[model samples]
Target: MMMEIYKRTVVGEDGPTVVTESVPGLRSVSLGLWVRVGARDEVSEQQGISHFVEHAVFKGTTSRDAFDIANSLESLGGNLDAFTSRDVTCYHGRCLAEHLDIALAVLADLLQNPMFDPAELTKERRVILEEIQSVEDTPEDLIHDLFAQSVWGRDPVGAPILGTPDTVNAFTQDDLFEFTGRHYRPSNMIISAAGHLDHASVVEQVEKLFGSVPASPPARRAPSSAPRSYQHYYRDIGQTHLCLGTTSWSYIHPRQYDLLVANTVLGGGMTSRLFQEIREKRGLAYSVYSYVETLEDTGLFSTYMACDRCRLKDAVEVMWTQLLVLKECGITEVELASAKAQLKGELILGAESMSNRMSNLAYDEMYLQRYLSMDDTLKEIESVTLEGVYDACQTLHDEQGMHQVTVGP
Candidate 1:
């Protein structure tokens, strides 16, 4: 099906940005109110305020109680949800085309009228404390956070999204309001929607709901540089969790697609070299894969594996062999073609979801400040040469730049 994407600024340079993707035959629409403030924007003391605000907003808005907020969209066979990431927070919902106005209204109300009641704040504190404990109890999940911290030290990029227990416990109603007031300005927001929707109506409703919000200049905090390091934690778990990672380029780096191609060849799928070498060929691990994560300004390229403690050494050696081979010899034309096909296929398949499309619009705007159509992305993937992939591999495995984090007894 053909789709149309429209981009607009609600007022001017300091106003909220809006992008809508109109799909011809979809019955539902997905909408997101994206604030460019996230865990990465916090200082040492305010570590988890961004995530705290995300949860507190649902406790009660000025017009809707928690129960009412919960049912606002579910009553119409739709759903509302929100998430906090390192770089952004999004409150989003999906509803039938006929209920677009209601969805937008509920989102705007949550942002505009959150009460941040002291009582609700107290209840949420306990929930989030328990949530932090849950992560501590899960070794596989905790290792990534540890790895990130090891890589970036105390920088906001490496800090846990859920924040530490001490930090979360100290968050008061005032803290949420303070952070929200500073970062939730219209200029730092993006409204993106996909599926059956009209650009004009969405823009008009958004302007009425948000146009009056005062603008604030974006606050930029330069990231502190940190060196690579190794860490190991002893746990009573049966299997060892290993994460070997190195730094990479930012989201908008010219060689971003090359990195993607190299990452795919490393651990992207069942056909990927790491999966095949570590799991299928040697039975060293049951779960082995590589991933490329690019934030707004920096990125990480990591390969993760969970295996029997006894097999951890073998798995690490084999993973290293794969990396060295990729760096030294690069990928064959056949492997390159297969990786490109895999990426293009996934990109196309992902576009089948309206939520993905909605997110793509926001992400592209956030990172590139422009829309990158699927065709453009496919062409970029197609343009990655074997030499480019080699350079990407070499960049990722820089000597003295690699870091390792392991968790297991």
Candidate 2:
């Protein structure tokens, strides 16, 4: 099948930004307004406001009451949702192509004009506080948070995107308003749409709605620092939850493809070394895998496992031994081929929907500043070799790279 992608730039009195493609096929379109600011952009005092502001945007807008917003989307059989991550916040929806205009209108209203109602703010604070508490209650979730804190230290990336109870409770409407005013600008945002839409018409609608908003000065850049080294945490839980990680590379790094294959062989799939060795052969844990999280400037390769408390130390040692094996002996041709096949299959399956495509487009534009066709991405993954995988693993296994966090009984 031939995949056609359109690219254009919408420039107005407000600001200029790129919109890559609006795919046309399904009855529903996935649309999103992505902003560069997220948890990492905030200072300690402002840590959770990025996420808080995301929630507040749906409370009400100048043109649409919260009820009206909900009713309008439901009337059209659409779903409206939003998420805040370490690096970005997205307000997105999946709606019938016929409701594209309505969806865009509501989205623009929320992005540009949330009222930040005082009572609503108070209620949401309670909700978010409960969310923080819930995370602490779930060992699986809390252990990762502890792991992140151990890995990234106290930096914004290490900090939970959802602020702590103390911070979440302390947040006021003023804080949300201040954060929104600073980060919610046309230049800082990208409006991406996919499935059954004319790219030009969507661009025109976006320009009309967002045209008058002024661009703010660029966001302050985050500082660069050396990779963090090994640190471990001990906690009491029935099963030992562990996150072992090391600094890898950014999304744009040259060795990214190699790292991708290495991760797959180590932990990406059911047949991966960690899964086969730790789970299948030894029956040490029900869950064991490795993966990579790549950001704009840096990345991490992480292996997560949950095993009986008695087997925790052995699990960690076995995981590390596999890493060392990959670095020293590398992978076999058969293993390399299997990893490549699995990675290709996953990519093909993941892009089969408009929502997935919309998210891919938004992330590519935000992080890589360009869109890569599916064929290009697949070709890169397919071309990875055993030597390349070994080199990437070696880089990740540097002494200054590893970090660990464990929670157990």
Candidate 3:
């Protein structure tokens, strides 16, 4: 049976925007409390405060200890987690539809009243420092951070989310309280939920929990400058990890789908040209893929591959060759049709998850300022013609603006 999905939005005059999608016949609900501040909004001294707060909140809250918070949802056979990104941070939970109250209560406590004990902060700082070391030891993961530094240069958007050891070590309990007090106000919050739920019920609970929290003005973000053309890091690793990319359109732009389709044809899946040529044919690398990330004001289109040091040149040559081919000569009608089908299938399947729907609600509210139904998104994908793909390829693969980062011996 086809489930009837209904979406609604409500904003207070002094706001923590609330949006909900009610999917009838579902047994569970996924909810998230989103904050607008992230790495991009931080100054150099507080590079990872946003992410630090994400971990710190889990340590304990005023009403609950760390163990209680950890077991809050799991005791009900559900899940709870959070993440900080370049633009926002989210603390979310999922549980049976009837237990929605528990999920909401636990998340609200974490958001409104993290204890951030000095002893806890000290322990978390060491844990985060260990995390930094973990990333440094993994070349494949570390290279992406280096790649961002290479691409955005000094832009705050390019700063690592985990932060450097110095900045993280300097963070105190007061720093967290200050950062959260500034960014966790009503104006910076969005409460989103999906699956079996009632919009008014959720809103009423949210208002009761958060009504007294005062609003604040939004933060100003600096524009990103032009990306550098190339960068290389020499590591003693046995294989070369290469990430090559260029700027692309923002998520809100009408042309975003064009870049999506272009990416699918290049290295999105096993059938993609880079995967077929570089891995299947030449056996240069076991993993090679292309990805696109569209931010609020800008985006990134990048390809990554890991290969034997000696084969790095051949692998890069093939990667660029495929990119140029797609740019100079657009994909065939059959290719376009196949890519469209792939995208539609993934979209439809992903929408079935309450978590994905909950996330889509917040993302659209934050970035697009409007919601797009599944039909709307699918139509946009279908509308991408060969000419559109060609234009996307040409625009995204511009050699002058391209950035390259390779980490290997």
For this target, which candidate reaches the highest lDDT against the unseen true structure?
A: 1
- Ranking 2 against 3 by TM-score, winner: 3
- List model 3 lDDT by residue over 187-224, tens digit each: 68889999899998888888778754565645656456
Q: On residues 363-407, what C-alpha lDDT tens digit does candidate 1 reach at each position?
A: 999889898999999999999999999898897676677889999
- Give TM per candidate: 0.97, 0.95, 0.97
**lDDT by candidate, in order shown:** 0.88, 0.80, 0.87
Task: Please give the lDDT score for candidate 3.
Answer: 0.87
Candidate ranking under lDDT, highest first, comes to: 1, 3, 2
Arranged by TM-score, best first: 1, 3, 2
Q: Per-prediction RMSD in angstroms?
A: 1.4, 1.9, 1.4
Off by over 4 Å in 3: 212-217
Instruction: Give the Cα error of residue 123 in candidate 3, in Å.
Output: 0.8
* Residue lDDT tens for model 2, 1-409: 4364757575576653646455555677888888888777888877788889888888788778778878878887888999998788999998998898999889888988899889988888888888888988887888777766666776777678898777787888787777878778887788888777888788777777885467674454543433655544466667878888766688888779999888888898788999999999998999998878788877767899999988887888899899888888888999899888888888888877777788888888877778888898988997887789888878656666577777766
Global CA lDDT of candidate 1, please? 0.88
lDDT assessment of candidate 2: 0.80
lDDT at 206, model 2: 77
Query: Cα miss at 218, model 1 (Å)?
Result: 4.2
